[model samples]
Target: MTVFEQRRQALKESLRVRGLPALLVSHAANRWYLSGFELADSQCNESAGWLVITAHGGDTLLTDPRFEEAARRVWSDEIVIYSSRKMEVVGAFLKSLNPPALGFEPRSLCVRDYERLREFVALTPTEGLVEDLRVIKDADEIRRMEASCVLNERVMLALPERLVPGMTEAQASWEVERLFREGGASGLAFPTIVGAGVNAALPHAEPGQDRLPAQGLVLVDAGGRLDAYCSDQTRTFWLGSEPSDRFRHVLALVREAQRRAIEYIRPGAPIAESYHLVRRFFEEHGVADRFTHGLGHGVGLETHEAPSLSSQSRDVFRPGMVVTVEPGLYWPDWGGVRWEHMVLVTEDGCRVL
Candidate 1:
């Protein structure tokens, strides 16, 4: 079934199970997921661009006239469009339907929006009513995400060639972005991190005009997006004549840690175990504290999503789940080494894509 149809079916099932008569999807991403209507930037105005889906399969798209034409062009024929100046009209319309138990996305609705919603209808906070359905990829979603990964991998493979010894970090960053777009990416998944030498110790360092050292370490963390799905990857390189023994040792340990984490990932495996395995590898190298961050995270519509791989995470690895296997060690006096690869969890094991 189409993504929208599947979403509608899932919502219907959720509403039936929860005893809710209708659901209001206010979050932009959730709305896009349910209705396939991309909200215009102006839709964030009070009560505009809201979607109300009834338990009985009725769908309505409420927005201002500014977005009527765009909404018609994008939404399905089943989605009835409502134009109004006052934002309260959406709530009034919902109340007019008089749903017994109205649902709202608890994770997406802010306190301010929740209070505003309370002004019109009784809203029952719903958890994962739509997000749970979105965790698994439909064929089209997977296709777009795979295309995004391909572009990301291509950019990663090409990054080394652009890293001249004297090029500024900002210069290299601009080139990387240019290459991503030229390579068919819609845009960078997030802000690019290009750190050399001492700056490499910072995990999320911003790219700057600092000229790269002729003989030091260079760490690059970047990715790109395609069709709204995202791909993230990180690779640390030796820009000098050759990495020192100390640097090589750190790189080897970090790569080994990342490898072990990926190896331990399988269907039904606890995410904490993978993180612990990475920590153990670092501890063996006497750099446990240097590995501060989580081992990995799920990547899809968002660069970082569910099923985080870390000590605090209780999520179990499942088949068809796309996650990153990244482990690193950073020493303030020295530098940092990180190896990241995006992989798909399978029945047997993870397959890096």
Candidate 2:
């Protein structure tokens, strides 16, 4: 069967086990995962389309009139177009089903939409049904992700050649984006972050017009998307000269933490174990609080996905999973250092992408 078909069958079984006759998939990522329909909304409130999948293998795509032409080209399933009153159209569809239990993604839908949906059917709130299935990548998915990762790595490798001291952070960020596009990436996985000096302390700092430091850290976190798969990597580089003793020490600690985290990745390994390894290393160095964010997250259709690597995460690693191992230490006065790399979880261990 086609990959989309196989995914649909898997989702069907999940719905069956949950005693749900049908599922209303609203998230763009989940929609794409199920039907291979490639469309996204500009904001959380907006929706390009929604999918209604039945246990009997029926797939119906509901979209607005604006997306009618594009939907027709991408989706071969039943297509319904709604104008102003989306709830009315959706309600009609659910009424036709008369399902005793209809599954819907509470995390994906707004309260207003969920409340409206409740008026039409007995809605069952579900989370991660599709995301759980997406954690494990297929061979084709891995191929696309690997290509993206290769493009990302190439862009980083050429940084020394293109980057110069005093170049604006915004300029450097644009250059990285250009490399991704020129190298055949569909688009950026996330905004190219080029943080230098004190600005680097902000983990998700936006690129600014500030000039690159003459001799300190420049943290670059970038990614590209190829065929809807995402590649994410971050590297901290010293400008002009070698880093200070403290900065160098922190960098070494972070790198070691990241190395141990990546080494701990394998099928059946608890996701939290990798995270704890990094946390413990930072704690041992008396900089535990400096590490602010989670170790990493699953990367694929979205830059961040399921099976998060965090202390609170109960998820376990599985073969074919692509995840990042990023350990960082931040200081407002001294700047921040982060090292990120993508790895594919294998049966025994993991392969650095």
Candidate 3:
């Protein structure tokens, strides 16, 4: 069987185990992951397509007229085309099944669409049916992600050379993009973030007119995408010949925190342990409040996926999972410093990707 076929088969068994006769895949990434339909829905109200998988080995692709050709190239068995109303077409099909209810991913449908679909058939909300499978990377996916990570690291290392004192954050961000493209990446996993000086305090700060001073800190969070796989990492660098005592201390603390967290990852390990390890380290240093956000998240077809590393998460590590380990400290007045790296969960421990 092709990889797509094998994935669908696995999903079929999941439905059987859940007492679901069928499933409606609405999330764009899940659709692509299951069927190889590369088109994406740019807006929440819009859709490139949907997959209706049946436990009885049924394979169906539902899309609009704009995606008919592309849908055929990916799925050859059954294709349903909707011209003006997608929910109506979808509802009618589900009603035909005439089961008590059918399972669908709530993450895929907006509230407006979900309400409309409710008028036609009983809907069962399901989560992680496909994601549980996607989190465990296949051999080919691991290889692709490794290549993307390698390319991403190269671009980040070269960013310092392309930047200089007084360069605007926007200019530095553009240079990061150029390096990734020139390094043979198809695209960026997400926008390159270049936060200079105090601007880095904003975790998701947008690259702006803020300038890198003669002696300050620069935090860059970036990633490259190759062959539909994604890579993500962050680095915080100093500008002066010698970093201030405070900066050196915080940097070392964060680096060590990150080191211990990475070492804590392994098969069957609690997902939240890695996150708590970093948080506890910061707390000991009396900077716990400054360490915002989770330790990291899984990376693959999407920049962020399942098996998240966060105190609120209830997952456990599993072999073949690719996740990031990023521990950061952000100070509104002093900017921020974040160290991120990707690792592959293995049988014994994890390998730094």
TM-score per model over all chains: 0.91, 0.96, 0.96
Q: lDDT per residue, candidate 3, 230-261, as tens digits?
A: 99999998886888888898889889998998
Clashing pairs in 2: none
Residue-level lDDT of model 2, residues 1-353, one tens digit each, is 87888999999998888777998999898998888775467787789889999987578999898888888876787998988999999898888888887888988899999889889999888888899899999999999999899999999999876677899999999999999999999889899898999998999989999999788889999999888889999999888777799788988999999988887888898899888988888888799999999999889999998778889988788899899889899999978999999999987889999
Indicate the worst ten consecutive residues by lDDT in candidate 2: 36-45
Judging by lDDT, tell me the better candidate of 2 and 3.
Answer: 2
- Candidate 3 error regions (>4 Å): none
Mark the regions of model 2 whose C-alpha exceeds 4 Å error after superposition: none
RMSD from true fold, candidate 1: 2.5
Evaluate model 1: give its TM-score. Answer: 0.91
Assess candidate 3 and give its lDDT. 0.88
Every candidate's lDDT = 0.80, 0.89, 0.88
Off-target runs (Cα >4 Å) in candidate 1 are 39-48, 77-86
lDDT-wise, the better of 1 and 3 is: 3
